[model samples]
Target: MGDLMHAVGYRKPLPVDDPESLVDAEVPVPTPAAHELLVRVEAISVNPADVKTRRQADPHGFRILGNDAAGVVVANGPNVSRFVVGDEVYYAGRIDRPGSAAGYQVVNENIVGHKPASIDFGDAAALPLTTITAWEILFDHFGLQPGDAGTLLVIGAAGGVGSMVLQLARARTRLTVLGTAGRGESQKWATEMGAHHIVDRHDLVDSVHAVAPDGVDYIVSPFSRGNIDNYAAVIRPFGHIAAIDEPTGLDLLPLKPKSVAWHWELMFTRPILLPEDPYQHELLEKTAKLVNAGKVRSTATTRLGPLNAETLRDAHARVESSATIGKVVVTR
Candidate 1:
């Protein structure tokens, strides 16, 4: 392996629109730990977290800001058992580590899964982070059952995570999926992604109540700060509310009256804290099965060019715009 490889990274925190925010440079090839696999990154998907992380990047060191990735395993650590050197894999790598913006990365095998055979690298790259998040939020947090009968409301439904949540809820469970989108295109995208009803983001509470007079059984708020109060008002008794974004000044006290359960889904939980948890691996494997079976499809709608400074900057800008309908992926 070479001592240094090409990568797109930033040395100092700056605005996403700044020309110097993301740069192409050379970085050292990382080695795998006992439980890690060294993967040659083929494609990467940019998420809102990438933009958020870049805005808070350290001023001293180069930070590679990417999370969703699909690639081939070039090498494996001594303790790795599920994957071998030639296998293709996909995963949302740990946030603490230098991400998949580079030529290669070291990720724990427990959090990685085999790439879906039916899709290309770009499509496969778009699934891991959002899929992991949606799966955990729906099944683990809300305890989704196959025959469940109720409405599931998803805030910001056109984005990557919400798209997955809509598809999974529609495919695996019998819930009526209600997705919120502000624009006309986003509403269409949400409906095509599996939303049974589209609620306007401008009038979240009323729009949701119009379709679901009895109130929704579950709420997945990908971006929930502004509507937290309304969420408490619209949810049915004993309903569950799951969120993944970082909301400020959030008060759950209002939910007490309805006996609503609040839950938070963070995809990095297993890789960062509970390393022994096999659910991430298990779920990714299941997601691959669902994809191959045509039950769920990729949300990668925008394709930026190769993994370079110009393309990455474009991706970051679009993500910061808060108007992207689906995942933005860049290939090697």
Candidate 2:
């Protein structure tokens, strides 16, 4: 096989409402570096990040805009002996790197993992980005005990990241997860995904009171575009809150009364901030093992075939619509 490969890309930023934003094109099949693994992408999933990047694409150069993918490692770099050819893997690749909407992609072995054995490629592709975000928030940032059960609140608990947070908390910890959703379907979906309780986000504080009454031990804000101020009102004293979305004009003052610790879970910060950390890879490997063991499941819904511009555009539209749950994936 030659080095050239097909990929989905955008030459310039366009509104998702516009038709020219995503395009099918050919790009170089990147060669893995000494610490990298070359993956042949069988499936790729979409997150809100894909939509954000698409809207803010740099016109000066072409941008391949995808982050989560499941594939097989076809080659390894010079010092990369951990994985060999033909290993099926899944990962939410680094943010600073070229994306996974392609036939082949090169990623650091540190960030990739073996796909879960219980599911197909499409489902596995949906997990990496969301699971990594949720895991890093509860485990790395808050230092929550995996077995220490507590009253946990997951705001916006019907989306991709929220669903993963629910499953992970249920699987690893005995925490009674109280997830927030506005609609009936989302509420049912959250409950099915392992939320011990589901409440409407409309009357959040009141709804939480009816469920936990004592207040939740931890709050995961997988959605933070709004309601931060309202959340602090109900957060337990000396509790922890972790958020993973864009903070638009948030008031940090409300958290002072509760002695609450607020954290931001940007999964990309690790690879972007400390790219050489071997411990991150160890964590990813462990998470993958859990997935393979059937302890947790993948979290995407839309699975279109082959990576391309049209598929990407459609995925972005769904994400922006806020109606899509789990992950929107493009599989080969």
Candidate 3:
């Protein structure tokens, strides 16, 4: 309803510890384009993507970097039909556009889903990005059918995306889920999220082999660079490996002998590269159903005050530390 809106963003790339890394400012509320909904963002969750983007040089002046958000629809473009004004919705928005750090953001109606009736805004905000990621990795990339019986090895299972992956794999599919977590608390969190077994990432190969014996059928590595080779070594023939992290100089040759299928899942790809693909919308809607039915739960572990630059910096630091379990959400 107002012209000015509160937003947190950065003018230049800097380390998370830098005071100027993220700054609070007032920006004009954005008008929705065709097929877009203008959302009044109520809560947002910080991901590693937020931290990585902040450290990159942005020639395009100030940039708002947040991926997951839940809010009420303030307005809708004439062409939008999936949502109406006052609808509570959640989504992992497109990276090519301005992100959800602002009080107001415009997102395509197709990529957004109705908020789950079982959760609050902060809890709902925690699901979109990670849910989309894990969903895509399982259904789109891995292509496993329901009642499919096999072992799934999820690296970084205590983190946001992996937590969702563990839950979805356990609840929807018949996959025996093996998750990795180094710390005691993290291991507990992973088990709660539905991992059948917890393996120390330090002993990834031996620990996994001790249980599976013949290697795993599927692998989802949210943070893969360090232990990718171990994954290659422990994967069964024709097993699928999907990753979300940006691992450089990865040698996939080791998988060639086993004919392993490797794929990368960037949650923004459907919204950015293939807007015509309706899978994201379907996945979000299904995820909401799962959450409402108590099949899956929100992973918002830490709430860092209100959505502001100062709090965002703290969230970024926590994510960068790579010790947090589940998702860290910031609310209004």
Candidate 4:
């Protein structure tokens, strides 16, 4: 319980290539508030959200910028009941708070879950954010049941969120998964993650239609900006489309003809706006059970050495490239 700890952060938004975009520093160790846990972060994973936040958030003062993390609970708030000191846990912390890219961070207990004992910190670090997003989309948004059988098309299926979407759907539902990825390695990765059919991203409509001729029953997309037409063309009437990315100038006029339902998923919503909700904790617990049972697997495809300014910068750069096949994690 040191008064201060080492961390990497930025004071202003800058390009990833800038030397000061991410810097090493020492900050006072944060103490847990009501219903919070003070974690000694052991591992962290990078996501497009990290990159987007780095580019958009002002921070004003130095601000740490990572969400997906696995670590040990070093302290807990007075009202905390879900976890205590020495407990291993994983979570995608709230975006409004200081993040997990530090030696210690405080997070609400309701949003945290026990880290699956079967996986190491790095692999466990890669699961929370993406798994929560995928789970919410499948069950909360789509209302998919375990017995319901239909086709689900996941855009950007080789990426972090997409990878989890594929695995969770396979483990929790009876949907025939169709994933969109580029040729070669990406396609292979998607298949290994449980995609029954791999649709080429370049030929979105035709590739999806080729596999599910009648049209897919549900679609989850991370990149929904330029693929709206293709989605509209390939989604069956009354089908649901859930997206996590922010697409500009998005008009739902076209989808109206098919009565397609478009849902937006932001994993941070529950943690930030509805802090009292216990569903994220419950969801992560179920996800851990699946992982420990060998039904869902970690998507940590690239390990970028240890957690530090240099390595975090490289991890951010890799995610910014928009070509990362799976999650990239950094260990302590």
Top-scoring candidate (lDDT): 4
Q: Could you give candidate 3's per-residue lDDT for residues 1-332 as a string of tens digits?
A: 78998999999998889999999989889999888999999999998888888888582888888889999999988788788899999999988888999999999988999999899999999999889888889988998777888999998888888899999998889999999988889899999999999987888999999989999999998777777679877999999999887878887787898999999888887898888676788889998999999999999989987889999999999999988888899999
Question: lDDT-based ranking, best first?
Answer: 4, 1, 3, 2
- Per-residue CA lDDT of model 1 for 217-297, tens digit only, reads 999987777777898878999999998988877888889999999898898988999987878889999999999999999
lDDT of each: 0.90, 0.82, 0.90, 0.92
Score candidate 2 by TM-score against the native: 0.95
Model 2 spans with C-alpha error above 4 angstroms? none
Candidate 4 wrongly placed segments (more than 4 Å)? none
Model 3: ten consecutive residues of lowest lDDT? 220-229
Q: Is candidate 2 or candidate 4 better by TM-score?
A: 4
Per-candidate TM equals 0.97, 0.95, 0.97, 0.98
Decide which is better by lDDT, 2 or 4. 4
Tens-place lDDT per residue, model 4, 1-332, is 67889998898999999989999999999988899999999999998889988999888898998999999999888989999799999999998999889999999999999999999999999999999999999999999877678999998888888899999999988899999888688999999999999988888888888889999999998888878888889999999999998888897788989999999999989998899999999999999999999999999989976789999999999999877788899999
- Write out the backbone clash pairs for model 3: none
Q: Where is the poorest 10-residue window by lDDT in model 4?
A: 221-230
